[model samples]
Target: MLSLCLRRRRSPQSSFATCVLPPFRPLRCETLERRHLLASVSLTPIAADDQFSTDEDSVVLGNVLTSDRLDGSVAPGLTLRVAEWNGQPVGSSPIFLPSGAILTVEEDGDFHYDPRTSADLQGLAGGESAVDTFHYTATPQFSQIYVLGDSLSDQGQLFAATAGTFPPDPPYDQGRFSNGPVWVEQAAPGLGLATTLANNFAVAGAASGTENFNESLLGTDLPGVADELDAYLDAYGPTADPQALYVIWAGTNDFFLPFSDPAPVIANAITNIVSHVGNLQARGAQHVLVMNMPDLGSTPYGLSDPVLSGQLSAISQAFNANLAATLDSSGLAITPIDVYGRLEEITDDPDAFGLTNVTEASFDGTQVVLDPSTSLFWDSVHPTQRGHELIADLVLEHLSDQGTVSIDVSGVTTVPTLDARHESGQAGELELWLSADDASINDRNGPFEYTVDWGDGEVQSVQGTAAGVSLTHSYDALPVVTPEIRVRDQDGDSSVALREVVIWGTVGSDRIRIRPDAGGVHVLTLNGETVASLDPTNVDRVVAFGLEGDDFLSAAGSEIAVEFDGGDGRDVVLGSRADDRLIGGLGSRLLELRGDADLIGSVAASRLR
Candidate 1:
């Protein structure tokens, strides 16, 4: 949410302009000179914004032109021009900007600019002051993310070693312990790296040292964090890739080792972790991120016993304190992430993070929650995909703060540009245009493949070699839905885009139902077929119309507000616990409210009982 504003020059010949830099703790301003036309402009020490910012990891460009002209001249033959953009040359007018940003020169010598698809701007006439905005999304600076830890950061080393008999895929996505992509995989694309950029070595149930508790307890041979690091050094040698981001997040299992006294166990765990960090630093690893332990006392495993919970809580705090102090004194380029503090915040106010359950695991031995996204923990230990996403956000924020990575307004080379539109004359069909720019487009980066998550449990993928491709999908359900589209190249680099579309019901009798959870609201047919699903983060309310015949409309366990309309014939309407609006358009109607829900509706030809 921090922005850099380059105000217009005061005079026609003035070479310098006052640049209002981001209020990064101690606010200050810098003078930037337009030494030459189309020169690249660079800003240093950009800070990350607070939680209230839209994109927590990005730096934005606000109102590049605050006055009628950037050159500050109104005389004939003089016009507004862009000197530079984030250290990249603003080549020429009418040129395509990075990440789908647009810049157009109007007929009346005016300039219209749009930073990205997410930003909206109006054309400003020559000599007329206007604000133009755009966002600077980060690009990957590290070669790869080298991981070493336990199940929290594991991406299937244990599963592969166990021959896929552990942590079953039905609930654990691919090899991850969570129900979906882990934090590292989710963070990859945002950093302009492919999911494969995460060369994971973390093993499930790994302790900080060479000994794993799972090996002793379950008779399995899983390598610990120290062993994982050793394996990396054996493969790549002692001179580790300095360009890579090395991450070490372990020690939870060490606390679980059968020990009557927790003091020595906690001490050993911290010592082992700190020692391993030192090993990586000694091996030429420059960029390292170490995540501290979360409050083990708050986990379902710890909560089972009140005495154990209190003991584990104290142990976690002690371990974190020791690890932090050790890393600080070591004077290495190691960044300590406070996973304990963030986890505490989420558990303290679950609703703020769109989580309804934090006290218990979503997946018990028998079943999972109605929506795992609404839960923090997937099991007694690992977090759900949504929980991992929050962790990724935290990691990215810290990286941005430390200047290890930044928003490169230059362009996104691996991420594809996406455009979506409704197919002409096709009410239920949508067309998507996908394209990407890879440095090695003529070599290994091409034949691009596209994956579409229809948001209704239906996923489809298509591959092509063209610069741009148009793919179409049809929907059968009514109401609004947001579909996520991802494009990946042969090199494993990828980008994601999302778009919303509204589907309509048929003339025949339709049974419409809305079920909302932490992820979003799901619209379903009477036969339990999903019509559409909306993400609550991107959408606010859902509106549906049951047009004609005897219709049934309901908002059953919805956490989001909904508006339903029974267009014609006899209708049966049900409201959820959330405040909902219902309209009985024609014929006789029956309206029912669930729980203590407030209802707004027209009573004409309607019976409310």
Candidate 2:
């Protein structure tokens, strides 16, 4: 466990009354749409003023106001009259609540890149708020959740990719599944703990032997992990060394690259990472979870070349085995997940694993070609929004047991599989298969909730416990249509388990439905195809519609964004504040951010609070 403390270094300075409003917005944009949207939103840095007191207790100028007066509830849009310090950038931003005495002045430093700092402004009564500027020392809790690795540690990249907003030459590139309800966040609350994270450090294309990545991945060099830790500690003092430190799904990139054996090479690098992590004990991090590399050979990237793929798989396995042995011997109490095994099931029999078709999901041979409304990939190795959710669910399951703090994460899916066929060019039928490992299947209540969104306007739903190990469903589709299936557990964790079962071959009919009998089990036919025989309490919502031109809409209005499992291939309007509604979706939204804006939609979309 790491111990952190921050000494009060800055003398509080209250400059000329600079009215700080709600809070300043963050500079990072995970989505191109958001980047464009934000581009339209003007930003003006408030200049500083220097005529105020520096007393540690006195209210400062430029400080953010989060009290009742400017707490976002201010209808008709709120405004603030902010003044600057006479001539300095070191003053705070203060606010005047309706109570008269200058309300607390908040330093943006405390809420760095988060929306919570401005939560108090969302529902504030419409009125004028005043603020002063000053600097407040930041003090973090004693716990943190560190996601350390090379560029893979960067959550921004995952966010950008999932949002289809990858920046050119991004400095924040943490492969797919790094953003949103990643394993670290999912596990924190469940374990009755709070975690501060250090995201994807495993840079894309950067491996263990790479000069820039090897040690830098752990922040161990000249401006290395040590310095980074120092900076983080200064900002967030006395916080838990992240509830858990997630080491990369590394090794694959290390071995997959043009390296031979790559075991000892990778193992040595890994040893360095472990050593760095072990040193964190002095800084406070205790629990650590290491994810073994997935079977790259089964992946679209690895499969590109049969020969290369086979070689890589062998090396990957050997490396993982060695790594596991090392971890076991270290007695570091690390939880090593068979990530490769989980992915193997999905890649091997996608039709049986509850996963979207890798072929359909890919784009341009190299990338997982996405159809925006149907496809789930933007490139060869990365995942679309839906892909990220699938991976997130697997990781979160492990996290939930850690017990940081409990959150609703029941609707997610594990390994999903899909099957579809077209009888004629006019219409077709579809079937879906999903894995049932560690599922909360119970005969008493129900195990899962299933929803079907047929491209057009047809929808179907059911709820029940699993009688067997797999869940299945069938759908009839028109010539140009895509179907999406969404499943959720009792805990609210949900996933758009499958997407776009293109039925081009044939089908006798355009529509059909199978209702479960009194016993809760039934085999159904849609357009002459026997699909699902759900046990009564397993379905939730089902709909049918034309898929080709359907767009998904998204609804907003909450602290966190709503999670939309159904991926692209439909129109989505994530609605306005009150009556917001999300339309077409191929899969659940992996991440959503409404920084300073007041959200009025679903909360599932938000990966962070």
Candidate 3:
């Protein structure tokens, strides 16, 4: 068979050099600093005696962060991720820093700083170790994504944007409506936009307001959908750009509880939505997305009055119908995410979505203290971070259908290893592993998908796993084979890796040999299925990936030499009786020594930092 291949560029800039490298395990820095107002500050490496200013809100720092490296030499300039919480991203701005430098600024919840790459993220929060990283980049498929709506759209930046009277919910530093990064936050990186550019102008408890104003005249004066547009315009003026997708998700409050609004009020609300879209379209917003509200009558508040809940559900359906009618008739580019259908999917069969307690609100005393990771609804209304992630997955599906996504195979860490020349007419064991143990996308505790190309006409797709999964394929009388593998998460973000193999009807002398380098790798799971997997092999040359679980890995084969990267959490890794190398992750670790020559990455090693 003839080998055919296609390659997508990582960036317009840079050279192409592929080598044996470590897996790309992007970091998930959980910034659970609830109650922080606003503090997007600077990065300045403090003196050895004072790494921090002791101030929680804001700090004074310089642009050029000067600090001594572990090598006793001054560090050089480094590239850092720039992010904003409460606005629309206007352009594809790239920051170029000089080589040979790394920057780190002390930060916590309610703070703002250029997010660091996962490789360089480390800090402390609430006396416990905390970390975060930026994993998204603008690719050819799409540049940026702008959001408009209510709490769901607002990824906590609204609190700091408005400086609302209420302190932000605990553990949510960025003013997100949920406990952690919302669906947009998790989805943006996969869609090729930086996680920081998950810019939003949505406010909590927002609704489709009257014709003139954003907030309902009869209800609280929350920022209206139109008002959200005004905020965007006020910040970045007006422009019509097709590089980014415009997302609008609102209208739950329009038909929410205390559902005693008159007919005229409802009619005006629909008009308000139309006007909002018209303003955006007039400003050159090319791709517009509108998500219909779910069954609000089923919320905690709605449940209090079941009769009203039913009415609210009916009204929500009608509101969604009216909103769709206007968008379809207006003749502008428009798409709708079936949020109404999705919520039903989650509640109708909670087990499928890993959701429990959908009917009742996650309540504890008067406080709305939800883990958000699991609970669907934090309280009466807002979804948990997990809930938001599910919504983002729906959005990602839409992006995928539009063919506007750049896949990052590294995010899933699915690497396939096989000998260069395989005997034709024979089934060769082509081993594949997906190890995204350290890959922490904002809110998703992922279960990703792995699509494998066996260099022939055969293609296979499998769900990722916690401990990892292996795939093998056989070729019969094949001429040449080139294997390519790629991974996609529920949110549709992807990374790709490729390798070529020669198929001979005879035998070969030796196989391929590659050493792992400084690349990130991790595992992402979905619905308890292994989208990202790890394998512990007792082979002569071993490449074992340790994700975020208790793993008992030991190399026992003769002449065993292993390279192991242990992920977060307590782990027990036993080296070969011959010789081995082990790298521990952000967790308590214990190693069993059987090798006379063993290498371990520890606290003193700059490589771990």
Candidate 4:
């Protein structure tokens, strides 16, 4: 993965592919109104820690056949290839280069977009990597595919689309359902799709779209998969093409409650699936791929419990059965991707798919990996990269017979995707970081004139220069909102970057990030007024900032390494949780160091010691 970051490289003619918006984070918004998507802060370039830095290549930064991030439009027939920041090739796939900038994912999964060195689209424009072309009998298969489901279907899209807000960052990092690219990603090229992502609405922990009004808070944070579908339609509407495939895979979470009766769970899950599919069908989705649940009886999690395994298996079967039946009955043009049967087949004969283990989790989150090709499963529930390939092959075969369109993806140059940083605070502040290729950064081509629907009834039109812009806003009263940001350059080009923070937050409460102004000293504010001066040394941005009182609000920047600091209240601090240096603070404190490998500081040690 590229380790590039989004910072201004001082150059007289620097043509970057990213820009930043104003200071804003999470918290309240009003109705679903449109506003310019912008959030950015200039950070000083830091020296690499030697491990990541390598022999660099002269990758030119220019506008190389960029595509529309919103409409998903670019000349279809082109070769695509992307290399890591170190200039090592990831392998050739039939991807349409989307953005002009190259990005690198940090160890902590944070991203840096270096527009200085492009992904080298123009350099490789004449490469001989030919797209594997396929002849289809039906109309053009989906050029733009919209996916809605759970981790099983999620690619790095949730992170890219939602601006790394959803799934938080630490634990559920980098949107892919598996350790690497999921099945949907693996199948993109063969289906005539440029990138594996076309509006991947799938999020980790996504449910089967059967929450009540309060439960499926469409206007609020995350509700469920059905609500996800709703939001996608409301925001993006239907794909211009009728044959666009709307893929839905879910129901793993439905079986989460092992002790509860699994009957209603399965039934409700299928019902939600049916309702969501109907919504898609109504929205002109002609080709729909409905994947049933993989066999719960076979998973490592399921096999962990003998009796409970059987119960979960039964529920999974019932859910799949109902899914198949509903698709059959509703007469929707939905093809069932038999994930359950295919997964069981691989599990039964791991050698057939070149898989080794199917009954256990492999590779700890923050460590090196075991052989993924031979491992049928990445963790207990998700599949490995190889497993995703098998699923993709199965889906392709099904689509070949049932649907239409496959592309010659070789030599197709996939452009870069946009990046943003949006954070909300306790004092009704919205912090955002919006950027795209500097060449395309204008009122015509991006972060220039875009829509930021604050999920409330309010939408604003904000402006910024071509170099990049930043703006901040404070909500008077905390209002329930999911600030949906969509930035479009002059050409209506979208780097396919759109994000709506899915985490719930207090009106103005936020975990402040301490990025000292140049010399590491800045006066902090509550709401918009100055509250205190933050002057600290040796502060790291790795540790997360926690919120204080209702009135104590802090934006993401100008904060510190202290995860929890009760500045002036009767506060309870939890130590030994994350890896952070401890320091004692004001008010009555309760330091709970529940985890090990932690150092307790002075009187701060009084509570835990």
- Which candidate should be chosen as best, given TM-score against the real structure? 1
What tens digits encode model 3's per-residue C-alpha lDDT throughout 357-427?
Answer: 77655544256454445578765566777888888887765543210111111222222221211111232
Report how far residue 414 has shifted in candidate 4, in Å.
47
Candidate 4 displacement at residue 470 in angstroms: 84
Q: Count the backbone clashes (under 3 Å) in each candidate.
A: 1, 205, 41, 85
Error of 4 at 376 (Å): 1.4
Which of candidates 1 and 4 reaches a greater TM-score?
Answer: 1
Kindly list the per-residue Cα lDDT of model 4 for residues 353-466, writing each as its tens digit.
776677775644444256666787666566777888898988765543211111111122222244444433343566555554533222223335545665456776565534
Tell me the RMSD of model 2 versus the true structure. Answer: 35.6
Cα lDDT tens digits, model 1, 1-609, are: 232222222221111222333443322211111101111111111332211111211234333222222111111332222323332323444534443445553222233443333221111111222232332223225566788888888777777877775666776677678888888877665444544422788887788898775564445777888899888887777787766677889888786555444456666887887788778768766667788888877987668767657656766776676666555555655666778888988999999999998988887755786478898888766788999998988876654322111222322233444433322213355565666554432223357787888778889888866375777777776345556777776545566555343444557787777776444545445435775565655543455666677778887786555556666678887876665666665674787766443444454656774
What are the models' TM-scores?
A: 0.48, 0.35, 0.41, 0.41
Q: lDDT-based ranking, best first?
A: 1, 4, 3, 2
**Model 2 compared with the native: what TM-score?**
0.35
Residue runs of model 3 more than 4 Å from their true location after superposition: 1-140, 161-167, 171-173, 195-198, 210-222, 256-259, 365-371, 401-609
- Candidate 2 at residue 153, lDDT? 36
Error of 4 at 278 (Å): 1.5
Residue-wise C-alpha lDDT for candidate 2, range 76-177, written one tens digit per residue: 222222222111222344333322223332223211111112323221222323232232211111133555443333444323433433322221123333
The whole-model lDDT of each prediction reads: 0.59, 0.37, 0.47, 0.47
lDDT winner: 1
Residue 14 lDDT in candidate 1:
12
Q: After superposition, how far is residue 419 of candidate 2 from its true place, in Å?
A: 70
